[model samples]
Target: MEDGTPSLLDDKKRTSKIARLSLLSLFNRFGFALNSIALPLFALAIGQDEAFYGVMVAAAGYVQAIALFPAGTLSDRKGRGAAILFGGIVNGACLFYLPFVTDSLMIIIVYALTGVGSGFTRTSLDSLIADHTKKGNERTKSYGITIAVATLAASTGPFLAGFIIDPVAFPLAADPLFRYAILFYIMGSFRLAAGIFGFFTERWLHDNPDITPAIVEEAEEEPDDSQELNGNSRDDLITAILFGTSQAMMGISSGMVVPFLIPWIYAAFNPDPIILGSVPAVANLTLASGTLFVGLQSERVGKIKMIFLLYLLTPLLTIGMVYIPIFLVMVGFYVIRMAVANMARPASNSLFMGEISSERRARSLALTRVMWTFPRQTGTLLTSYLLSIGIMGGIVNFGRFFFPIAFMLYPVCVIPMYLAVRRNKRIVEQRRQQRELTDSVEVP
Candidate 1:
């Protein structure tokens, strides 16, 4: 393979690279999962309310949303491995500082800073994944495998963190604060482990010049009469914009209640930490299963159809959550909902990634991510305020007014992306037929 091109790597070498990167992803995801359950509880323990928790969550997203745009461009211009290393170090440092922050404001500030590092790591890693795998089915499968591996860590981290920190459950230490501190330390260690591993990985790549992928040049391409947009016939600008828009709407819908789910469950059901922790742990496990299934089967089933069917099932399932009052029933619904809703990720990622040119992939991905995060975070902030003011009042025994609105938006938001994908599919089939005709005429 040429230095700038990634199409020629032998299968074994590519698998090795993906494996190494996925290992790094495991460490990061575990750390994040620990904090995901812990952060809301920590806020309450420090005398802050759900509103403050919302602020903390939204602050991180706001920072990440701002940083991802440039991070993507940097990944394209500078390289993926280096960006991952830099992000891991920065993220680790912030997590290490988390235990020291007792004040609500400081906690939010430090956690928000973690977002900057996450943007760098996430953008670079996603682009690198695309770079390593062949496009279409293989790429989707790789994403599924990588994501499943990471989510496995996510499933376990919450269970462990909850067990260790729950004073009523474990009583490991006299002071509850001590347990929280210990949990944060463990989270920091995981992030630093990723940083250290990434550092060595980058060093090895630096030493091996032939294996390092050259930075893809993002120079403008000459206009092609046959192509409708950019240099590629299938790379439709409208499709990209529509996909991004749909994602942003989905984010907004989720942001309204997703961040507050654990807290809501705790306050409503009064479950112990173990049970509360199980929610996310189970959800992550189910998500891993769903992503893996979608990754493997998406090509066979058709990506758009699979995405549409899965998404359609989610809103119906979510509406059931609004009516159900039993904790076990709710958990079951939630588990199924998580599996069905998130299973669309790999297929959607493949669809979006396959449509963009390699040179501009990072930027386009960053744009779509920003669109999703900014709106979601904005919605989170709004929801927090509404919850605080009792504006998002309870709709029933179990549901908040925000809950149904969030799930209902799922199918609606997916519509534009569905249309866009169908259009692109049509364009691709037409081009394939045109090429066949050209080949037949030339042969004669």
Candidate 2:
């Protein structure tokens, strides 16, 4: 469009695009970090109790699960930019509405809307990145760096909310419900700002009409996406299903942790906003570090192998999560363990990317979410009820109830993942060796 042909960027547009995407992540995550502490406290304050908190969390996941695959498929057919832009708007509106919510039921509805927004937004971004890069090391590094930057930006969310909640800044800090509402207001404003970033980023992407976006100003024939008579398509499908199943196994444990961890910490330790914010700050910091490590190590270590090895650490961390006696130690354990378990996530995603064909990439990723949905949906509720009941003979909060049960359940998710990785790895190796042998024979 600038000179009668599609120029992906002309220095200025490139800078504009990068700046917007970076700021978009920073502001959006700042809002989410506020919710990390506020949502649970708000539920309890409204007299809904922990069980309702479970339902609130479940409601979001349910909506996300339902919306994910369809949204991905739609984006592939339509355009990734529209999906991302719409998602940011929906999330911003939902967060803005959070400040006004008083009734528990209304809160649950907002949570669901945000969940739908998350599904569309996440799928679009993942697909967008894949569209921009070919299947290889470039894709791996791009995914890793993107996640690392966002997580690092989000690390400040808890601290910002915590500082605002400090009695030094706000008078309502003493009243739990009012304080939570104020935090929601601040975070919502940031989310609204994030919507602006998404809008600009979407507009700029219109200039570069490649695999990343379905909206091309030029009229061209679309590639046939059919799988009939395509051998590689069948192989890719098999690998995709296998990879998705394994990722779901890993997701179940993490899903259970997010909704209830702060509440658990409050019940077991203290309710200070400083404590609530600080813990997540540490977790996000470590996640950023872990993602960076994967990006740096991708070429040195095989992505699939690194992913498998990193996941092997899950059971150990989850086990330690339940048995740790001191709150500080438990928090430290949570940070390290989470980092260890997720350090290779970018690599795992890259592995998935390498296996699937371009046409089905987004939906394939969504299918992975679907695989994890039921287990996580059930796990969150089950853990919440179990936590409510306490342990045998009235002893739950001590050390043997909420987390240990999840530790015991961790294997159920990862075992299938291990098998899937092993099978996929073997297949890949066989293909490589056969190709090398054929190449040698052809040369002679």
lDDT of each: 0.77, 0.67
Alpha carbon lDDT at 2, candidate 1: 78
Best-fitting candidate, measured by TM-score? 1
List model 2 lDDT by residue over 1-444, tens digit each.
668444554444544544455565666667677767667766766786666888878788888888897778777887776777677777777877876777767888987788887787777777766666545565676667767888898887776666666566555468766677677677666666665665566566666644332212234443222111122656656666776676565456655665676776776666477667788789889999889889667756877567666766665775676577688888887788667766676777766665667777888778887777656776677666665675343222523454544544444544554565566556666766887899999995
**TM-score of the candidate numbered 2?**
0.80
Clashing pairs in 2: none
Best-matching candidate per lDDT: 1
Q: For model 1, how does the per-residue alpha-carbon lDDT over 1-444 read when each residue is reduced to its tens digit? A: 377355545344555666776787787778788876788887777887888989998999999988897788778888877777778788888877888877768888999988888888787777776765555566788778888899976798888778876877888688877778888888877876776776566555446445322222235453222232232624645666778899898999889877876777777787888778888899899899888899889988988889888878877887776567899998988888878988788888877787777778888888888889998999899878877776645313324555776777887777888777677767766776887899999995
Q: Over 4 Å off in model 2, which ranges?
A: 1-24, 166-169, 172-176, 192-196, 202-236, 390-405, 408-444
